[model samples]
Target chain A: MFDFDATMPLMAVQFLLLTAILNAVFYKPLTKALDERDAYIRNNQATAKESLAKAESLVKEYEAQIAAARKESQSIVEKAQAEAREITAQKTAEAQKQVQTQKEQAAQEIQQQKETALATLEQQVDSLSRQILEKILGPELVK
Target chain B: MEILGSLTILNTFTLAELEVGEHFLWKIGNYTVHGQVFIVSWIVIGVLLIASLAATRNIQTVPGEIQNFMEYALEFIRDLTKNQLGEKEYRPWVPFVGTLFLFIFVSNWGGALIPWKLIQLPSGELAAPTNDINTTVALALLTSLAYFYAGFKKKGLGYFKKYIEPTPILLPIAILEDFTKPLSLSFRLFGNILADELVVAVLVLLVPLFVPLPVMALGLFTSAIQALVFATLAGAYIHEALEGHGEE
Candidate 1:
């Protein structure tokens, strides 16, 4: 079995041929498919990450807007409430002032009417007393 | 007389007979070729081709069964080549290393799995191509040529500078190493495969029943390991050739 012959070179050539054939048929296409799939997965992952970041930013922006709007609404409500309280206070003070003037005027008018009635009663009492005296005492003696 | 009579009976009865060193010769032009080796080598080639074709037929991103298996094999080869040849230079060498691994692996397994004895040959019986010294020598020689080519291509004439590295006295030893590399590579493979076949054959001959099964199983295991060892060593040789010897 120690024989050496042309089979060595021929087998080498056969193996080389196999290598070439396998390179063309097996290695090239399979590696290309593998590379393409790798690139596809990487591309999808990158885009997914980008979209997630975008969604997160949008969420933050909306939250900020919501917070600002809430603050603005609260301020507006407070301002309206303060304006209502101020207006109520002003209206109450003005009504009280008007009532005070009207009360003073009525009291003054009643006092003046009472003084006139007392003066008239006093004049009537004097006239009645004078007439009673003229009737009781004789008119010939008084003349 | 009794022993002689038993020997004759054993010879005539074909009780686990082992044949060795026989070849079916085929003449082509002026050179004689081993027809049995070619026959089995062609079968190995055909199997590889059909499997490759089936794997690449559809070429889907989501691979089917055959495609997945082929891809896994390719990835395995890629990793092996990359580990030996490094990341940068490994890509171009993948096909060569991959072919070596696939061819040897399938040939070995095929030899063990196929019932070659059933088909009677005119001269020698069919067996694994690697079991023949000629085939292993051819493969080892190819590895030698590949590494030399890789060295020459990468570093040009400077590849010869490795012979005299550290000291000029090492030149003869380095040159001797070149010859020994192929010798060892070829003999290791040839001896392992031949011994495995012989052990199984002898076991079967001695005990013609269930005793050879475990040895045959071990033979299969060794066959696969041999294929891997051959490919890994070949890749390592190429890598060594490509690497600069601290002179860079």
Candidate 2:
């Protein structure tokens, strides 16, 4: 007969029970915690990668905007300068025409004074009036 | 013979030789525990512990020969655990499962190597711990317990629900399957180790020296296989626990 002790079977059962209890108390949580930690690490890694890509793309978008703004401002300044030059040229021509008209009026008055000094004031005045009148008309103005 | 005389002297000093079965006697308050093969087994376990500890105590990164061997064994078990249970949930159980494998492995091989004949007790010869039904059954029961607890804790009452799955037609069978899992796992290991050890003992007896070498080699193989089988079942059980006993 095999040397079977009564307690031996109990010991085997106890072994089963003991290990089961140990697993319940220790192994299960240990593994659970480990798995949880692993998942957390993976999730964080994915989030990090996504955010990193987002940041990189945002930087690229900002850079493009900055470049576009620079070009737009450059064109705007160039247009404003061209407009300023045109206005300056137009004002200069207007001022020169006004000076020419003033010179012509002064010259006509000086010619009338010279005729009065030469003792033909009345005739000169008459001629001047006629000239002025004719100058108001188209043929005298052309002459 | 000379071995018996030496054992007597060693037994006088070390508690490792305290026998509890058939030979020596100790009366403690009218209860006597007999000394038989248990002492030799305890001594075997102790020696195993000491040798393993020594091998790993100052483990170098580069590893000396013994350290390398121990590391290889540990890493081998680690990989097995990783592969079977997966990298996700196999970390903590590595030590427990790996220790079980190493303990059984060393015990099995120890029986083959250390001339068991060289050690003597008053009655029967000492066999490997695995050869004893108690040890194998104990290991099997523990593994079963581990998986059961893991399953319960992981999936809770839903784990039991898994047993009543497949449209309830296979409920009874599933329950039976759950019960048989531990029995099969335990018996498989016990049967293999016991048979291998018995065969080797018989062969050694039949032929004193030469013919037993091959059987000894076979014993080594059996030891490794049993260890792997035990670990594999443990990993499978853990996997089942993680997945739960769902319909699939």
Candidate 3:
């Protein structure tokens, strides 16, 4: 049953030929396709992860910008309210000053008129007393 | 009457010989070749080639049925190569290992399924190519060459240092292991396949009924296992050959 002939070399050549052919047709192309698929999947996953990260960062940046804008708006509203309050206080102070000045001026004018009337009455009283004294002396001399 | 008639038929040298070694030898310019082995092998190779060409023709990322099977087979062989031959240099060995696996697997199953006896030759009949000692030996020899080549290529002159390792006392044994490796590899496949076929054949001859079905099923199972074993061992041998020895 153990026979060695040219069959060994022949079979070897046949196997070698088959191996080469199979590598060309089967193993080579099949593995290439499989590997390409694997690489494609890996690349896709990487791209998805990158895009997700990019989106998250963009969202964070947008939120930060919104917060900054909101703060700026709040600051602007506070400045406007403070300016309105200062203007109202200044106007009230000016009005109070004008009322005080008018009261003083009116008091001064009334005092001046009262002073003039008193002076005129004193002068008339002196004149009347002198006339009465002259009449009494004249009557004593005739007796 | 049936027993006598069976005996007469058996003696008349007709219908599945008990001694199944006879070959329909072909002489080509003073060279002889086994025709049955050639025919069956040609058929197996043709099937593999056609399937491979068709499935690989378009080369899509998403697989069809044939592509799926082919890809799975390639993935399996790749894993086998990477695991056994280690990660660094297993890529090149995948084709050889895959070829061996596919050929042997196809042959064993083909032998079991095909009614090769129907294709009557002048003397012998068609069967699995792996059933021949020549084919198995050829496969074993290829595996042997692969390991040795891997060793020489990786380590250069340092490949001989392994035979004397753990002290020179084990030199003979290590060398003997090399010879026995191929011997066992070839014989194991040849014997198992031959035995399975013979058992199924004998069962079919005796009972000629449902009894042979289980044996045939077992044959198919073992055929697959044998192919796996052969490929795995070949890969492992190459791995061992390629292993690094840090210094002298």
Candidate 4:
């Protein structure tokens, strides 16, 4: 068992040959595949992160646009309400002025009719009084 | 004496006998090799190759089961190498360290799990490649050579300056460490694996029942730890060489 012989050198040669064969068939290609897989995963992760950032930014932009549109629409509604209020006030004032002018014209016509009737009644009363006096006294004696 | 004599007689009746320090030798052009080690080692290597091919056949960005397992293993080895050698120098040495870990881990586990005794051998039965001293020594020597090569390549002749660092009187000790490194590495693996196998074999011979189950499990655990220890030490040695004496 302790004997040292030519087997040692030949076994060494065989081991070297095995090493060479393993290097060619095993180590080189396997390492290459591992590296390629690593790179592939890393690449996918990077792109995924990039797209996520883009989506977040787009969400923020759309939200801002929506907020601005809401403010603009609110202001437009308020402006329309204010304009309607102003037009209603103007129309109401114009209608009140026309009603006041019609009332003044009707009062003037009633006053004119009353004055003409008073004047005619006074004339009729004078004629009746004169006739009554003539009938009561004798006409030849008084003359 | 009577009990001992009777125990010897009882041992022969067991299903399998304890085998130690035996080998199936095959003659090459001018050298003899352990045929059993080679046979199991080829099986281990074939398993590794098939698993690797299946994992890598349909490579995709989104990995399936086999691909995921292979990637996990690769990542583990990368982290181990990086921790030892630092970021700058770990890339080149990942394959070497990973190969050592995988080979030793598989060999040790295969030795424990496979029923090599069932297959009758002419001489010695098959075992883990690492159970043999030759194989561990070869692995340790390779680690030594790798570190030395790394040091030389990175620092050139300046690598030798580490022996005299702090004081020249420590030169002999530093040089002695080089010899001890490989010696300890090889012996640690060989002894642990061989001892585990022996314990299991002895238990199986004695009881031949469910009694050896826990020890077999323990053997498997130790086998994995031994593989880890060997790989970690080898990586540390390489890192030490690459770091040089400049920092110290």
Candidate 5:
């Protein structure tokens, strides 16, 4: 059997060397990569959450705009209908005024014609009487 | 025939004394290497790597038996590391810590289970490398180096600052403590496994009855505990490296 006293230091040195080499080559890079990967994932998750929130707010804004537009359009339609009814009422009143004026003129014209006709008839009757007296007197005087 | 049979049983339980470098047949110039241990360690590591790879090869949602068992193991180690080191820093160390725990655990158990004598390689005997102080020390050194490097890299000159921090009154003791950390880490594993192996060998020779069974069970328990201790300390070291002199 070999003596333990002789080999102890050699063993220690070898172990120390092995650990140093291994840590440099293997351990450090692996850990750094892992850390980077974790950071990337965290960043991605944060971005996704932000986008999702933005999209949700955008949807709400669109819905609000649509609602406001619908309300405005409904009010516009109501105003137009009121204006049309007012115009129709104004035209009907004007037409009624014209008919009243026409009716009064026609009545006046009829009354005037009747009066003229009466006067003419009286004149004609007077003429016929005169003619009849002349004819009777002339025959008597000549006899 | 009974006598021969008893001799065979005696042989079966015998522990062979093998030299570290005796099995090495290759001589490159003046140097002789323990090709057996190298080959054995290689085999242990390779087999583990290959088996685990195979287990994970085509991962199934509703896994096959092997995949289920392996995934369970991997997840278990992952949880342990996560608990010890916290999730953020623990991810990178998972494969290393996982492999270390598994390799050690498998090797320790392999030493107990695989009858090296039966294989009869040209080598005197073969066992799990972790059973040896050299291999365990290597493992400990690797862990020490890991945390030390982590501390240095994470804090630079501040790594030394930690040795003297809180108060100058504590500096010398802290330095000594830092020096002893790896020693403790290495010996803790080596001492436990060596003792367990020795006890099993002794018990098999002395009392071949129900005694060795309990001892073997204890050995298994110790093996697992040792692996856990090594892994936990390694995790704590990494935590200390990253955290520095902060309050827990």
Candidate 6:
């Protein structure tokens, strides 16, 4: 029917009431649930991203330290080898100089001993010839 | 003689002559209300309330069957508001638009589904609340008020300034459209629902068996379409009122 009367206002009021009630029970809760799930997903993704970045940085730092340590150890071993070689060469040179001085002293001692022995033998021979001449001339000169 | 014989057929043809303008009037405080509209509408509202409460009581991230369907339906309604009213301004008006769609949708399908013939009325038989012109008029008037409220609230008194813009010549025509908006909204719903009911009734009277099934199915489709049309138009009107220009 085309009648308006009280029905119009009443229907309006009823619809408004229905809207209010439905908003409370239906729209609000559903939106909340959906938004909650969305936020949870976004939060989890952020956490995962942060953790991955941290782990990557840690791995990089560890690799750099290992590289530095390997270089340091290699330099230490090379330095020790250089020191040992220098010491060995210096000791060999000192031992060769001492041997040369000892050989020269031994040669001088042998030359001096040979000269003393030759002089003693020559004095003995001269003394024996003079005694034999005196014994042969002694009797006639006295008569 | 032939008239009398045809009158017998007319009598037997309908369950009750389509009570086009009839209402079981209730007198309340110097005002008469349509009782049948309220009766069926209350039932529709009660069903909506119960189903809504049941589905949403134990709200979970993991949805159940009824809850899933209800969410899909509500999401569809939200999308309608968003597309019509634009994105930022749509959230506030969801309740208003959702109520119109659900109320009309439920009422129309209720009229089509409920066996109101079994429970007879004293004056006229029971039907959908939308079958009454008064109810549609009330809903259309609310829509007009809503758009006007949205415009006034959003744009302040500048809302009325659009009437004379581009020229003052179209002011009267623009004002005339305000009246026609409600008229068209009410009549479209009332006419379609009433026609569908009459057609289905006639078919059932003629064949009363398998013949009415397809028409009934079509009636369901029309019911849903009408509900969507009403809600979408309501949102569009509000959208227009809130916009800066009417030159388009």
Best by lDDT: 1
Every model's DockQ, to 2 decimals?
Answer: 0.74, 0.04, 0.51, 0.71, 0.07, 0.52
Task: Provide TM-scores for the models.
Answer: 0.89, 0.55, 0.80, 0.89, 0.59, 0.74
Compared with the true structure, model 1 gives a TM-score of 0.89
Off by over 4 Å in 6: A52-143, B1-17, B246-248
lDDT of 4: 0.89
* Every prediction: chain A TM-score: 0.83, 0.62, 0.59, 0.80, 0.65, 0.58
Each prediction's RMSD over C-alphas, in Å, is 3.4, 12.8, 5.9, 3.4, 9.2, 7.3
Better of 2 and 6 by lDDT: 6
* Cα displacement (Å) at residue B9, model 3: 3.6
Per-residue lDDT for A29-83 in model 4, tens only?
9988888888999999999999999999999999999999999999999999999
> Sorted on lDDT, highest at the top, how do the candidates line up?
1, 4, 6, 3, 5, 2
lDDT of 1 at B41: 96
* Docking model 2 quality class: incorrect
lDDT of 5 by residue, B45-142 (tens): 55665655566555544567765666667667778789878978887777667656776787777776766656666743576656566667777767
Shift of residue B25 alpha carbon in model 5, Å: 7.2
lDDT of 4 at A110: 89
* Better-scoring candidate (lDDT), 1 or 3: 1
Candidate 2 TM-score versus the reference: 0.55
B1-248: candidate 1 lDDT, tens digit per residue: 24433543575434344566878989999998899999999999999999999999899989999999999999999999999999899999999999999999999999888978788888887999998999999999999999999999998999999888778898999899899999999999999988898787777656777998999999999999999999999999999899956653
lDDT tens per residue, model 6, A1-143: 46668888899899999999999998888767766867988998999999999999999999999999999999999998998998988898888878877877777777777777767767866765555555676645634
lDDT of each: 0.90, 0.64, 0.85, 0.89, 0.67, 0.86
lDDT of 3 by residue, B1-248 (tens): 24534653665334443446778898878888887788889899898899899889888889999899888888898898888877788999998988899999999999889987667788766888888998899999999999999999987998999888667898899899899999999999999999998787677667666888998899999999999999999998988888833432
Please name the candidate that would achieve the greatest DockQ relative to the true structure.
1
lDDT of 4 by residue, B55-98 (tens): 89999888899989988989988998898888999999999999
